[model samples]
Target: MKTRKRLRSLGVNMIACLLSLIMLIPIVLILLNSFKTSQAASDMSLALPVGGLHFENYTLVIQKGKLGVTFFNSLLYSSGSVLLCVILSALAAYVLSRNRSRLHRFIYVFIVLGITMPINFVSLMKVMQLTLLQNTRIGIILLYTAIQLPFDVFLIYSFVGKIPRDIDEAAVIDGCTPLRLFYSVVLPLLKPVLVTVMVLTFLNTWNEFVLPLYFLGSSSMWPMTLAVYNFFGMYVTDWNLVSADIVLTVLPVVIVYLLGQKHIVAGMTAGAVKS
Candidate 1:
């Protein structure tokens, strides 16, 4: 039995390793191809690097893409959106999970519909024009917040429902105000789900292109996604620089994902299994 179990474990490990490599192949190819000459990169070949350290493409991308500005813009939009969306969604989730009224149920359904329904850009454009938010960071942040709220609320709501109701009662008995109860007691308890919301929201905002393209007018406010899109146009044939740009764009997401991966897994499973 011991030998059999060992063999099974080894088999599983081998399979897992194979899967990891399979997923990693494209990324490896991209990195390798980025170092190759423009023609080689255009061919998308994975052969050993021929050209020694082709830094020109990277420099060209940096100079034209205004990578520093766009990187900062993406960071601001993603982080700001995450911050606002998570806080509001947490509060809304707690309330929705605890409430049993028809109105609350309707509101919950309406919010969740965002996940199912596609965004109507025309309506959004009109709203933005009305609010004078057509070309600003705050406007873009608010849009992201709205777009992310439904999923965040739903996830956090599900997670919050698992917490014991007795805790709320205890907090009230101690004369804690509703806001205080949430901030002091409930919010900390929802950390796992909150982290999940933050990471997911940040990723979505960071990678978004459509909304930014329509809403933001100034190149100064462009995110990495838009920058990458424009850069691709500028260097359509220069695959080395394009690949390098792709690497730069993806690197932060990889880092953020690795850092918050534990919380992401925990949050994904938090309220799913009753046991």
Candidate 2:
């Protein structure tokens, strides 16, 4: 039995390593090709650059891809959506978790059900147009917030449920207003989950491609994903430049994830087993 268990464990570890490599190989290829000459990158091989790195690929991509404007657009959309989603989801979750009323319960279920609901882009675009939000920056930000709210609410809802009510009661006894209670007392306690939400929302908004394609008609307002797509189309043969553009587009997301990864793990596992 001991030998069999050891074999099983080894097999599992081997499979896990293989899967990790499978996912990592493409990223490694992209990074390597981004530094190679256009001819060298055309094959998209596993081999490293033969000569010195072609650092000009990144500079050319930044210029030709108009990445400056797109980077700002992505940052705006992601930060705006993250702020809105975190604040709104936290407030909604806290209230619903604390109230436990029939209506609140129904509302919470309805919102959470959105997680599985498929978006009808045609109708969504029509709504955006009717609201005079099409092709607008704030409109796209709000769209991202709406898209992310369901999961954000669900995550924060579960976390809020884990927080003890005694703290809320004591704050009320101390003459804390509802806003003060939440901002000062509850919000501080929600740091782990809030950080998780911010990171997730930022990533989602930053990487979103389809919504901008449909709703944003102006190229100037395009985010990094759309910029990368357009850059790919314009420089289809320049694999090195395309790879560089892709790396630049994903760099911010990678940095953010690396910084907040610990918070993400802690938040996700905080109340998982109910102690």
Query: In lDDT terms, which candidate is top?
Result: 2
- The window of 10 residues in a row where model 1 has the poorest summed lDDT is 266-275
Give the least accurate 10-residue stretch of model 2, judged by summed lDDT: 266-275
The backbone clash count of each candidate, in order, is 0, 0
- Local error of candidate 1 at 71, Å? 0.2
Which pairs clash inside model 2? none
Q: lDDT score, residue 169, model 2?
A: 96
Model 2 agreement with the true structure over 119-139: per-residue lDDT tens digits = 999999899999999999999
Instruction: Give per-residue CA lDDT, model 1, range 152-210, as digits (tens).
Output: 98888888888999999999999999999999999999987888899888888988989
Off by over 4 Å in 1: 1-22, 267-275
Model 1 CA lDDT for position 260: 90
CA lDDT of each candidate?
0.88, 0.92
